[model samples]
Target: MKISMTVNGKPVSAEVEARTLLVTFIRENLRLTGTHVGCDTSQCGACTIHLNGRAVKSCNILAMQAEGADIVTIEGLAKADGTLHPMQEAFREHHGLQCGFCTPGMVMSAVDLVKNHPNPSEETIRAELDGNLCRCTGYHNIVKAVKAASAKM
Candidate 1:
């Protein structure tokens, strides 16, 4: 199938198999590997990406389903001059990430969470982060980062 979509503010079109996962399309075809594929089953939110202004696990979505969608991977969050998003900055400042394997997805999820709840409490942050799992950190800093970003965003 030939699918066209806006990815990272650019128009992108490619031929993909019907069974090709959105994560594979983004990582392999589009060469945006920041959206990790930690688990192909979608249990982990490591493949999270914004599809048409909402976050979804790319591993659980088909490339064709995103045909006309506006996609934003972790790479798209930064400004053209490379200014990190507030959430990204908060993650760095709060040390939300440890090994960095889950940082991209965690950051993506945090962006959506803060967008939805601009004034989230620690409990709200924890509830919103239910999908994303970070084995390295116990989520102390991640929660703090989200709380900080909620104030900024």
Candidate 2:
């Protein structure tokens, strides 16, 4: 099957198998490797990306499902001039990541969370991050990053 979509602000099209997952298309076809495939079963949010305007687990959907959709991966969060998004900067400043495997998904999810809750509380941040898991940190720093980024965003 052939599908077309706007990825990272660029119009893109590709030939993909019907069973090809969105994560495969993004990472393999597009070569945007920042979106990791931690768990193909969608238990881990490592494959999270913004589909249209909402964050979704890329491994959970087929490539064809994103046809004509607007998608944004971790790479898209940065400015063309290389300025990091506030959420990304917060993650770095607060050391929100360890092992770095889950960082992309965590940052992506945090962007969406802040969009929904501009000034999310610690409890809200914790509740919102329920889907994204980190085996490294205790989430104290991640929560702080999200809270700090909320103020900027």
Model 1, range 1-153, lDDT digits (tens) per residue?
899999999999999899999999999999998999897888779999999999899999999999899999999999999999999999999988889888899999989988888898899889889999887865999999889888888
Clashing pairs in 2: none
The lowest-lDDT stretch of 10 consecutive residues in candidate 1 is: 129-138
lDDT of 2 by residue, 1-153 (tens): 889999999999988899999999999999999999997888889999999999999999999999999999999999999999999999999999879999999999999999998899999999989889887855999999999999999
Model 2: per-residue Cα lDDT at residue 152: 96
C-alpha lDDT (0 to 100) for residue 113 of candidate 1: 89
Please report the candidate that would top lDDT against the real structure. 2
User: Residue 42 CA error for candidate 2 (Å)?
Assistant: 1.0
lDDT of each candidate versus the true structure: 0.92, 0.94
Residue ranges of candidate 2 with Cα displaced over 4 Å: none
TM-score of 2: 0.98
